[model samples]
Structures are given as C-alpha cells and as structure tokens.
Target: MRTADTEPEPASDHDGQHFVVRLLDAWYVACQSRQLRQRPISRRIFNTPIVLFRGSDGRPAALLDRCAHRNAPLSLGTCQDGALECPYHGWLFGTDGGCQGIPALCGSQPGRGHRVPRFETQEQQGFVWVYARADVEPKTTPFVFPHVDEPAYATVRYQATSPGTLHANLENILDVPHTAYLHRGLFRGVERNKVTATVRRFAKHAEAEFVGEPVPKGLLGRILAPRGGTVVHFDRFVLPSIAQVDYALGENHVIATTALTPTRDDEVVLNSVITFKTVMPRILIQPLLVPIGKRVLAQDRAMLKAQLQRIQDFGKEQFVSTEVDLLGPHIWRLLRQAARNVPEPQETTPDLPAVFENTVELMA
Candidate 1:
C-alpha cells in the first residue's frame, strides 16, 4: 500500500474549471469529545475502511487500519507506548504511522519501508471529520457554537444514526411550506395562512422572509411567540452547510436552531440545541424546556425515518421535485460539480463557468 505522502491527491480541477471541492481539504470538524473505547472505531467513506485511535497524548488520531508488516488490522492489536502494537507479531507504529518498535528484535528497527497511512484528525465541537482529498489547506475553523459554549449555558446532545440520502433531509429541513402538510402538529399549524413571499437569489445565497402574517397558530406560536402581535420568521441558509430560522419574539429572542450534518450519504446526525439568552436560573428553565426541545426532535425522527425507508426502496432516479425543491437541485448540482473534478474559484475571484450563467445569477 502507498504511504499517505506517496499517494497522489485528487486535484481540484484537472481543467481550469473551479467547483467547490469539499472532501479533499482538511477541515476542523469538532471541538469536544470524551475518549471512545480502547478499541478502534470503524468508519468508511463511500465504503473505504478506517480506524480511529486515541494516541498516548490522549488525543484522537486515525489510520488506514491495515498494518504494514502483513496487512494485519492494527486495530486488532493493543495500545502500548502510545502506539498500536500489532497483535500478530508486536510491531508498534507511531501516531505518524511509521513502525517504531519490533519486540523480538530489541536492537533492530523495522526500517524506513515499514509504515501505515495516517489521516489528519482534529476533535472539535464533539465530532470528527476526515479529509479524503489531497493537496488542499484547511479553510474552515473548528466547529463551534459561540453562545452555547459560553459560561452559564446548559446544552444536550442527541445522536441518532439515521438512514437515507442527506440531500433529501437538508431540503426537507429547509422547506418551510412542507411543514403545513408533512409536520402538521409539530413545525407548522394545520391551518394554512395565505401569505405571498418572493424569493431573491444572489451568488449562492437565497432567502424567503415571511411578512403579512395574519399570524401563525399552533404550539410554537402559542407558547414561544409574542401574544397577539405580528411575528416575523426569517429563514436563512448559510453557504455549504447551516440553516437557521429566527422567529422574532420581541427584542433579541430567537426560538430555535437546528444543525443537520451529513455523517454519510445514507445517514445524518441532526443535533438540535435550543437555548434562550436569558439570565433565568437553570433550575427554572432546565426542567421546563429540555424535555420539550427533545420531544420536538423525536417528532421529526418519526416522520423522517419512514420517509427514508420509502426512498431507499425507490432509489435515486424516481424522486420528484416541484418549485419548492429548487434549493435541493442547486445543492445536487454543486455536489456533482465537485465530484466531476472542478476547482472552486476563491471568494475574491468572480470568474463564471460557462456551464453556469454568471457567478451572481441562479441558472434558470
């Protein structure tokens, strides 16, 4: 097997075309994690096997899982001297993935040719991200929640290994109109309030701000929103990943935040942390709201899990989209462009690809 350095990296563009290549560059994905078990945790990207290990520094690191000696799984071995000692013959490898110790031969080294591949690792925000592409510097900061990370904040994590394409789920979460039907009791009210809204697009961003609300009804409107007054719902979708809808509940009062992450193509981990920036005592708010916030997530899971199964059976070719599914189409186009070997133009460059209209306009 080729060493990490020897392996040729996938270039952003074989031609001069620039597309957003997400997988190649190293990205700081998490900020917090308790140690996992001593055993290796298996992960696959599109189906390639990898093993995650905690080095002697008590930090998380990953390897190709295959040992260099005879391709024995290094994870099958035990951790000694801060490295994995091969169970088969006691060949130990360092965090850099080079064979460091050969037990039976005390004075002899395994030599320079013996090494395993190392993957770039960072633990932030409570998760892990592996860079599968090559020749790119990391452009993203560690995953963070500025408000939640502060003192006097209480947060909870919900991790579920969901099934189905992440693209479908991202669009579903961002599609506000569907809640009137798909999530009748949870997200939106059963009654349809007629409000006309316009969608304006500019350079990879779009927003639908709701106005003239004869007012929305149901649980959120009742308990969370201002009583007998107009409330504005501004749903914003930040580039690459992140969607947040802030319902104006008076000055500086925001109702919710939902972060949907693609753990894999067929699975996603949706972590919803709902907090109010109030000086209220923890005893008062913790008991009153934590259960309700978790219940909101449970409501989504019941519906989405069923939808996922149905889609997997039908496969990708049969799914249909209406005018509301525009955002999803753009997401797919971008992902495909990345897979087809396109490089991304820097934020400073405004050059347009011939396949796209202008960098500023949405291709209609």
Candidate 2:
C-alpha cells in the first residue's frame, strides 16, 4: 500500500490506461451476499469477467470466469460438494481456484499447476467484496454502512445501474444543489434558503457541513422531519468510490451510504444502504421508505442517463461549476489523483488544518 507522502511510480499518460491500472488495485463490491448461492454467478468489474459462488462452508468465493482448460465460462457450470464443476469437461475447482478433480483422468491426481485465477473476497454488511487485482492483497477493508443492524435503526438496501461515468455518478449522489431541481417535490423543492456550508478536503476523503439550514419541505422531508426543529446536514465523499449523506434532526437521524462499482467506462453499479433511526417501527418505516427511496433513485438514474447521452452527442463534457457545487471539484480531483496513483497529504494530527476549506451560501 502506498502512503500519503510516498512518491508514485510513473503512470501511463493515457487516461484510459491510467484508469484501468489504478482502479484494479482496489476492492469493489461484486454482489449482495444473498445473491450468491449454490450455483455460480457471473459479474464484471472494470470489464473483467468474474464468477462468484459459495464454498462448502457457505463462505463466498470469487474467481476469473474462464476455465483453465478450454476458456469456457465457469459460471455455466454447477457447484457440487463445495467445488465448481465445469460443464464442458466436469473438472472440479476448489474455492481457492485450484483444480481438484478431472473426470477424464478417472481418479488420477490433477496437476498442481492446473487452476483458474482467484481473487480475494470477503463478506461484510451483507455484501460480497472482491479485490480487483488477483495477486495484490487488499490494504483496507470494505466501507461499512453506518447504523446497519443497530437497535432502533431501520435499514433499506437498493441497487441500480447508471449510464454514467464513475465520477459523474458519485458527484450526483454527493451533490446537493441538484436535489432542489431534479428531485423536485419528491425529495426537495425549489425553495431558496441561504445556508452556509463549510467544505473540507483531505487526501482520501472530503465532506461539507451545512449550518443555518431550514428543515426540508419536500414530501420525503415532511415525512422525515415533520415537527421541523433544527436540521444538521452533511455530505461526504470517501476515496476511490463511496458517498454518504447524513441528516440529524434532534432525536431523528438518517444516513445514506452509496458505493460505486464501475463495470465499464460508461456504466457503473450503485449499491446504496440507507439506515435511519426515528420514532417509527421498522415494519412501518421500511414499507413506507422503500417506494420513496426507489423513486428518488429512479429520478437520479434518468437524469444521469440524459446527461451521459448529451455528453456523448457533444463528443465531450463542457461542465461549468459554481461555488455552490461544493463536493464536485473535490471529488474530481481526488479521483484523478487516485487514477494517477499520486498520494495527497493525509491528516496527521487532530489539530492539522485541512488542505482546503471554504464557506459558501447556497439554496437547497
């Protein structure tokens, strides 16, 4: 793992090459833990095909989708006795990707070197994470969804694919200004309120804390903060690809954490886990929240698809952001730096000042 102050190796000048190289070194969410069962399932990350299945112990395992013998897809096979059996030749592979049995040999021992490439995998918070690089060990754990499985907290999970770049999708989730327009009555209205946001940028993370904000007036907002006392809001971004939005109103609190997994240059998968602690029972809260949350996500997905189509038609992006676009520029910078494998300054001590800090007024 590279440290904050360490110098990066010479990276390719080509943006696409840099993107592939840098992103392959990190861990990405492959699928929900419940999705993987007795049969093999296929997924793609960074355009690389992968197969996921459960071992005999019921633990998740990930491997390159191709079979070592004839390049057939392992996902087309079946799982028997904790080993993946190739459909073409009935070869058996263990969780570690080592070929354990060869039906053709009739009880003969398989060669030690015959195996498929396997990636590191772990199950956390009901999601299965797979490290992209097969040889390199993961330096950090998967991002934890806040307040999940905690007492008095109602959780809802959502998954969707957006036709946008990773950066664009992340920025859309962490951007606040769009909520007032794109989300309109469903999430936030076109109401104008002068709120001060203190933006802070760090090496691998960025956050904006808002003050003097009024309670939201949208449909969901009305349901969240009906009494409308004081509202404490925050939007944060974690490096490589995670965004979190937190809202606190006295005893009521809501947190939405989204993790982005890029499948291609123009396609990305969003896995969002929302946890809220309010004066409502889980049974009632979940039933009411799922539809509203789905609507909000659908709105964002349509907007991103249109945005991506416009950019494609124009042959490039021509975005002009203002000061109110708090986390967009910061997220872009961090992603670019990460793509180049360049390290920024880390927060060494609690008293250390932020790399960049500013207060801006915006209407929510």
Candidate 3:
C-alpha cells in the first residue's frame, strides 16, 4: 500500500560493502511478472540472496531470503493471506518485511523489532525489478525496452542465463564481428565485405553505426530480408547493464535489446526483447522467429561459457582491441568509472569539436 511518495526509509544495518556499490544503486529485473504467483521464489543477484512473492493485494514484493528468527531461508516457507510464514517457526511477515504474528504467542502480536530487510520493487514492461541496495533509495528507475506494445511491431521475449560475467555478456551482445564467425550459416557468413563503423561515446552511453555493410548471406537474412535493398545497423550500450542492436532493411526493421543482471562474479542472466516491424503477419512471423531466435541464443550461450572457462584457466582476461573493436573498450571504461563512483571527464563543449567520433573499416 506504499505509494512512491511514501516509500519506506532504507534500513541502516544492511550490508554496504559490495564489490560494486554504485552498480547496486540501479534496478535489476528479478523475474518475469508472470513467474511470480503466490508461491515464493528465490533469486541471487549481485551475489546476494533474495526472495520474491506477491501479497494479497496482487503486488510483488522483494526481501532478503533469510528469516530473522532462526536464519532459515524464507523462500522455503509458504504464503498465507498476503504474508509470508516461516516454515521453521511459523513467523508471519508482511510485504514490508515487518513481523506480523508469532505462532507460539497464540494470537499475540509480534515485536516491532523483528523484521527482515526489504528492497524496493517495481513492475515495468512485464518484469519485476528489484533495487539492489537496501540501504539507500534508488537513484533511477528500470530501463525500458524500446518499441514494446506498439501496434506495428511483433514482439518476442525470452531469457537466457550465461556462465560469464556481466561485462562479458554485455560486450558479447553488442559485438558484431563475432556473429560472422560464431553464428556462421545461421546468422551471417564469412563474406568479409569492408564495412565502415562510426563510433561515439558519451558520459553513460556509447553507440556504433555501421555503413557500407553487405547484406548478410545466411539463412536468417534470406528469411528476414528477401529483397535486401539497403541495410542499416547500429549497436548501443547504456550504463549499469543494457545493450541494444537495431537493423533496418528497406521497409523492415528489427530491434533486439538485452538487459543483463549478475547472479555472481561468473554468472549473468539476460532478459531480451526482440521487436520487429515487417510486412509479414504476426501469426506467421512469431512462430518462425521463436525457434530461430532460440538457436542463435544457444550458440552465443555456448561461446560465452567457453570464454569464461578459458578466462578462469588463464587466471585473468587478456584482451587486445583494434579499431574495429568498436564498443568493447568503451563499455569497459564506463563500467570501471561507475564502479569507482568517478565521472567521465567531458571533453566536448559547444565551442569545441566532437569529443570521440571515429570511423573504422573492417571486413565482416
């Protein structure tokens, strides 16, 4: 029943020594809205355990998974009349993490001092988002997926978890060169046509626009762009963790946006929304696109797993970037600066020339 203006104050004793404190200030999707019913579910984000459930009011709530009474996981307990009951000792807790009743007290009210830490929750774009930092109010809202619910577009949504760090997963999502080799016949072939990429970097964002690119000579291209008049491509990254790729061919357009959430240092969950506006009908396009999308995601997942394993074996990341490695370096720098709570120096002003703009030629 708490409105945005009357939100609860943050807990004072919550853990604040996370590896990336600034990253914790942002919102991350905990689960799809349809996934959370009355049953409690557990998720680990930023290496912190959390439990999510819906109250009797049909609103979602998030709290630390542990119970204050005996340190038992609350996710294992059951829901009763909008409150969570601890299975070990039957301690009833409300959405606000307040102790509602103690079974042993025989209808006596529980002490106000007994409570669990709670995180702010918001439902947007059919997903449940949780603010990671329980000790501070959220600075911003969740990132919105583009072109959602538009009448002209047909949308497909799915999630995949990769055995790689959050940065690695995000970098892979926006990297275009890997698609030619890794996806091979499924997505693109090794035609190696010279392409020009114009890259730009901002305070909390970065993007690359590709030109002079040849039409993809793959099964996907054949199906999506049969005529293939002209192709326009762009890859963009937003701070915290979001990557988007857009493709426009003639009158058809496709946009793929991914939001990355870290479950641990070496694990990440990707929630992706693929939207396209084409001449094809929704009924036919959705059925064909879903399987093809799954196949492409499976390939990326496997490669990411292999990359993580090699990095683990080598003890660290050894990466070399060339001119065509457009967005990887920029993404890393932005994340590093945000982790340290340092602002990127602004080099461009009204009187000065553009700060970072370059064109690189590469074969794809």
lDDT of 1 by residue, 181-219 (tens): 655554457566655444433344344456655345655
lDDT of 3 by residue, 143-180 (tens): 99999999999889999888777767887889888988
Q: For this target, which candidate reaches the highest TM-score against the unseen true structure?
A: 2
| lDDT by candidate, in order shown | 0.54, 0.82, 0.81
Name the runs in model 1 displaced over 4 angstroms.
Answer: 1-32, 35-40, 70-73, 104-108, 134-137, 151-154, 196-208, 212-216, 226-228, 236-241, 255-264, 278-299, 341-364
- Report the C-alpha displacement of residue 12, candidate 1, in angstroms: 16
The best candidate in terms of lDDT: 2
Candidate 2, poorest ten consecutive residues by summed lDDT: 1-10
**lDDT (Cα) of model 3:** 0.81
Q: What is the TM-score of each candidate against the true structure?
A: 0.71, 0.91, 0.90
| Model 2 misplaced regions, further than 4 Å | 1-22, 346-351
Full ranking by lDDT:
2, 3, 1
Stronger candidate by TM-score (1 vs 3) = 3
